[model samples]
Target: MDFATPRRRRPAEAIVPMINVVFLLLIFFLMSAQITPPAPFDVTLPESENDNAARPADTLYMDAQGQLAFNTARGEAVYDAIAARAAPDTPLQIRADARLEAQALARFLPELAARGIAEIELLTGMP
Candidate 1:
């Protein structure tokens, strides 16, 4: 009787390792990428003839109804709300509606200066 050695079969390549690698790359990219800034709420930024490309600071939203909302909250006193969250050195950005009255602006602009915010930027859409 002749004796022959049986050949062992090789296992197929696994996709698990590839999937793990893909997931790891995705995680790495997500971690390394810059995080999006928080808007907290949505505002329809006003339109302007002149616009600058400079990156502005945290935004303040003012509705057409003369209501002040730092992002989304409708507070009793806008100054108090601002003072509670923002520091003296924090940059200020204002996003106000086109219908915002001058009196309303006068009420808060001086207060912002008094609070020691060095510069403030008003964001608007390009016309």
Candidate 2:
């Protein structure tokens, strides 16, 4: 003739195992993820100590002689070609030689800006 109330049972799930799994996944991603540098055309670029900057795919190159190139093609032809292919919002990267004067950049940037390209990045390598 007993009439005592039944006891409640707690959930058997443990957060420790879940936390361990999360940590393992984090470590796996950290180890598996690879970082690769962007390959622009062959050009001698300016050197800098900062190497953690992100690069854009669309690059404009200026050689030591102040000759311009987009990718591999040289001179104004490449500039026109790039202008035709690139969108207004294309991220433009400039890889100019250290000896290349600022006047070269100044001349082209205005036209690039006029074409609705506002985002410009200067490429530099680790010294």
Candidate 3:
């Protein structure tokens, strides 16, 4: 006659603990991730002596090639598009090339001002 005792059955509760841990980790990562707005182009901004304040959420760019873009989207007239999207309360940041002509910069200022974009922020790299 066999004298071996009947094998005890293990509880099926292990899966429940693993599932809970996985869900907790997923929630943590989602909360920590940051979402940023896209840019129209890739241009190296000129550095400034004073680099105060953080970068703005809304940015408009003008590259050295005289191309106008918004939030990394090229082939668009920046002034009109930015004016349309901008409101008096929300300021628009301009990241223009240092080598860009003064006349060109001068021309756009009035357009931006006329649209009630009072708070203008210029972005520059760290010197």
Candidate 4:
């Protein structure tokens, strides 16, 4: 007859706790992150001497070649989209390539005004 008691195995660790922590971390990051749509095309913003910091909204993109994009719309269609979305009081931001011609931009401004866009802001990078 055996006098000694049999040894018991240790219980397995719980993976549920780790999974819960991982899910919690995921939730935190998702909530904290600011998600914005990428620019329709690459743009190299002009530099400015002013230190003014402004957040972009209802943005229009202009390439060096004078290509226009607003949200998913491109070229002439961009104007219609902008006209539909913009309120007379709401400001529109333009992210134009530094290499874009000033005359091209100047020509474009009247079109925006014709579309009833009153307030406009040009977004530029800091030197």
Best by TM-score: 4
- Off by more than 4 A, model 3: 1-26, 72-76
Residue 50: error of model 3 in Å?
A: 2.2
Query: Model 4, poorest ten-residue lDDT window?
Result: 8-17
- The full ranking of all candidates by TM-score, starting with the best, is 4, 3, 1, 2
Q: Kindly report which residue stretches of model 1 are placed more than 4 angstroms away from their true locations once superposed.
A: 1-14, 32-42, 49-51, 54-56, 71-73, 84-87
lDDT of 3 by residue, 80-104 (tens): 5776674547778878887778688
Per-residue lDDT of candidate 1, residues 1-127 (tens digit) = 7588886655534667788999999999999997756654456666778867747456677776766777445655666666766554667878887777868977878878776667887778887
Clash pairs of candidate 4?
Answer: none
Question: Candidate 4, after superposition: displacement of residue 52 in Å?
Answer: 3.3
Task: Give the residue spans of candidate 4 off by over 4 A.
Answer: 1-19, 86-88
lDDT of each: 0.71, 0.74, 0.74, 0.90
lDDT (C-alpha) at residue 60 in model 3: 75
Model with the higher lDDT, candidate 1 or 2: 2
TM-score of each: 0.63, 0.58, 0.65, 0.80
Worst-scoring 10-residue span by lDDT in model 1: 7-16
